[model samples]
Target: MPNSLRPSSRAAASSARSASLADVAALAGVSTGTVSRAMSKPEMISEATRVRVMEAADRLGYVVNGAARALAMRRTKTIGAVVPRFGSSSFPAMIQALEATLAEQGYTLLLSAPEGRREKEPDILRAMLERGVDAVALLGTDQPPAVLSMLAAHRTPYVQMWAPPGSGSDAVGFDEHAAGAQVVAHLAALGHKRIGFVGGRSKDSERARHRFEGLALALARHDMALDERAIIETEYGFAEGFTAMQEILGRRTPVTAMVFGTDYLAAGALAALDQGGIAVPQALSVASFNDNDFAAYLHPPLTTVRLPIREIGEAAGRLLLARLGGEHFEPPPMHVELIVRRSTGPA
Candidate 1:
């Protein structure tokens, strides 16, 4: 057939379908491999070829197929993250920091919506792994065996956030148990004898369980105990905190102070206390964890444990980046301070 009988190169590049690497290579007068190198590792190709391929790609409105690129490179440059739930304040804050830190290193964050059920974690993580994520970021230190096994089978690099320093994976967090102990010690030092605890479910939440344990032990040290009648374990929510506080009040346990697992819960409990005509620190001292910005902004200004949340997130991201780079990076130690505010006082 005559050259005129064949489709023109420009017309072929402008086909209705999305332009492919072949079209770009053809338009740039280069090979498909050269186009790949020019798009991915431009340094590997000549500047002239790289610019020509880029211009052709631009003209064709060609978008790099991430999946195909990952297939060729064996890395997606994305880190998958799955947390217990998004209902809490701290995780979201930590995630934001993690995303920003990862962005600094040019890694996209791929999040799994909810690791609500422990049993569902395997599926969630599996979906993430199947997407060719370079690494994973989990909320807790311990994972169900299936999840761990799957990760191992795939040889995926993973790190845990807000977890104790163990479990055979890179982890970044302050000691949850210590945070609890600090909170109790602060309240007890203020002469709070009868302290009630409101927290997320301990059965599935490792952090909650650790905090509960710390509170119990610290209360023991102070000659008090975690009173069952006054303790309420609920989901991570403001309304839940409010309801839990009301329930604690109904228990008739006569507590002088209340400790919440997180600032979100503390906020709700404060609302409940205010609505119930109880004065903070004056009537009942209230303290909690995660010194979120709102903690200082609350009416009574919560007395809580100030976690290095964003720093922890940045550290976690750095740990993963180090792992990817095959460099040695320690999970830096983070401290949690007992921020004494007007929310707590003499009992």
Candidate 2:
């Protein structure tokens, strides 16, 4: 027989009956209401009574049924957020902002990540929904179709972060395309004609694709074109960026400057360039997106676009709150700016 099915010496006492709130109240010499208040709203009861009720509950092994309480209130008072990844990115800071803002509103945040597998997003989202999350916040508009469909069917209030507003959904983010264009224009103004771009696969990320599109537009405006051989695509990581940079350098196309998808990747590329004895801003001017925490501390400092990650997260939380409150208003697009650091210069 399975261990669970086997009887033990304590089985008779355990199988007698599970403890209930009434049982706890009886032992504490209080009413069931008092016990309930002590567990749910301790401030409403005296400290001594709360302690007695708690002790009775502990003695009886009684546990509060959160699911029952949530059902009665018609809300779990919990918000969920799905991010792409966590470490070595701005997501952690953004999540912190979300948690802080939500806590102020008496709501808790449940965070989930796909662990680098886009296909696993739907399952993660489904799990959140099953847990009775009051609302959800998605990292970007580029969510899996199944996840979107499930969210729509569930009629859950949700907002998209890190993307522009007015996409038939509540969103709190800046225009990635515009930021990309600004970087390219800045490089062009510095007289970098032979430029290269190293980034993740465009198909996997709408933000990356928009940035690339913006770069293309800027290049066209400057009467220049991206060298086909100079474009390198890989996973979004420092090591990947380093390897991509080495590949771009080996192409013999004489790239005078480079643009990366993120500062993390830019840092990796910088390390690779340093190993090759290539001086930044002299041998190759480099720029990228997202002025992350480490962007300024880099050896030469990174010339990148600053995306207001924390602000976007707080705004996303507010948008969800507004949705829950049944308010209909679109937020204006957040602005991004180019930060000219030492990483890029005249080619």
Candidate 3:
């Protein structure tokens, strides 16, 4: 009889009924040592023998203990993702795709949110490291010096997303600046000579800054400029958009059109304009970035720039995985385009 068949073995087997090396060996008519080798270093076993052992293990409800596997391999097949937030449709959809793709390679995705608050980044990274993440994904190109130092100290692979053009950072996203410029160019082509831009406050967002720079470049190209008084920078929110538009309306500049930093902002602008008795595209043209799903259903619809938001997230996942596996990667530059709609007309 096999060693596992001894009287003493009966209790041990019962205690670990979920399955054990001995159980697999017995079921496959092999030695316990052979089963151990098959579980730990499968390549050493013959293909026929390995398949039999694996099938027996499956029948016996055997699962490779990841903790023990990690200890032996010195690798944790988990990636960390740290983003500003994850409330929008784009983030969720991309994350779903990324998770599914990673699952194919037996990897797991660990997500963390700092809400664009720099103060929380270090703590969040520490937590991720504690969980033994193999790599990390960051948002935007302008990573803070402290975060960069943390990643370097651990020698962990990191990636940035939703970056600007010419960022000089390892990233995977479209040029936000160009997206903004497209909005400006569209407004200009619609015969709107005077344009007011509703922008997100740039204190914590390098992406927002790039978007504004692109709009400025577009204005300069048309021999026009944003009225300094009409430019309203507020938090990235609908209320902020509403208030920004109201402030622009308060200005003496005859605002023929208003470009917003995001679709959410545009929606708020629409509400404000409605309440103020100002007609859209007639009294004032409204445009925004990130052709969000909500943009299509707005009262007059939004003419905006379409962001490849889901693709950006999926790319971020692949980039992190490649780096974790010691694969060489040259992160691809992504591009965004303008989606023309009925939000603007001849001014």
Error of 1 at 59 (Å): 7.6
TM-score of every model versus the real structure: 0.84, 0.81, 0.80
Give the Cα-based TM-score of candidate 3 against the true structure.
Answer: 0.80
- Cα lDDT of candidate 1 equals 0.83
Q: Is candidate 2 or 3 superior in TM-score? A: 2
- List, residue by residue over 1-347, the lDDT tens digit for candidate 1: 11112234653846878988888767777788998888777889877777787887887889988877678777888999998687666777788889998988768999876747888888888888877889999887778999879888988888888887564447787777788889888877888788888887888788888888888888888897667798888888789989999888877787899899889999999999999998987999999988988899997999999988888788889999998999988876788899898998898
User: Candidate 2, which segments miss by more than 4 Å at Cα?
Assistant: 1-65
Best by lDDT: 1
Supply the TM-score for candidate 1: 0.84
C-alpha root-mean-square deviation, each candidate = 5.0, 7.1, 5.0
Candidates sorted by TM-score, descending order?
1, 2, 3
The residue pairs found clashing in candidate 3 are none
Q: Against the unseen true structure, what C-alpha lDDT does each candidate score?
A: 0.83, 0.83, 0.76
lDDT of 1 at 323: 88
The sequence of per-residue lDDT tens digits that candidate 3 reaches over residues 169-226 is 4577777667877887788788878778877667777767878888888889887768
Reference-based lDDT, residue 33, model 2: 97
lDDT of 2 by residue, 90-139 (tens): 78888898888888776889998766678988899899999999999987
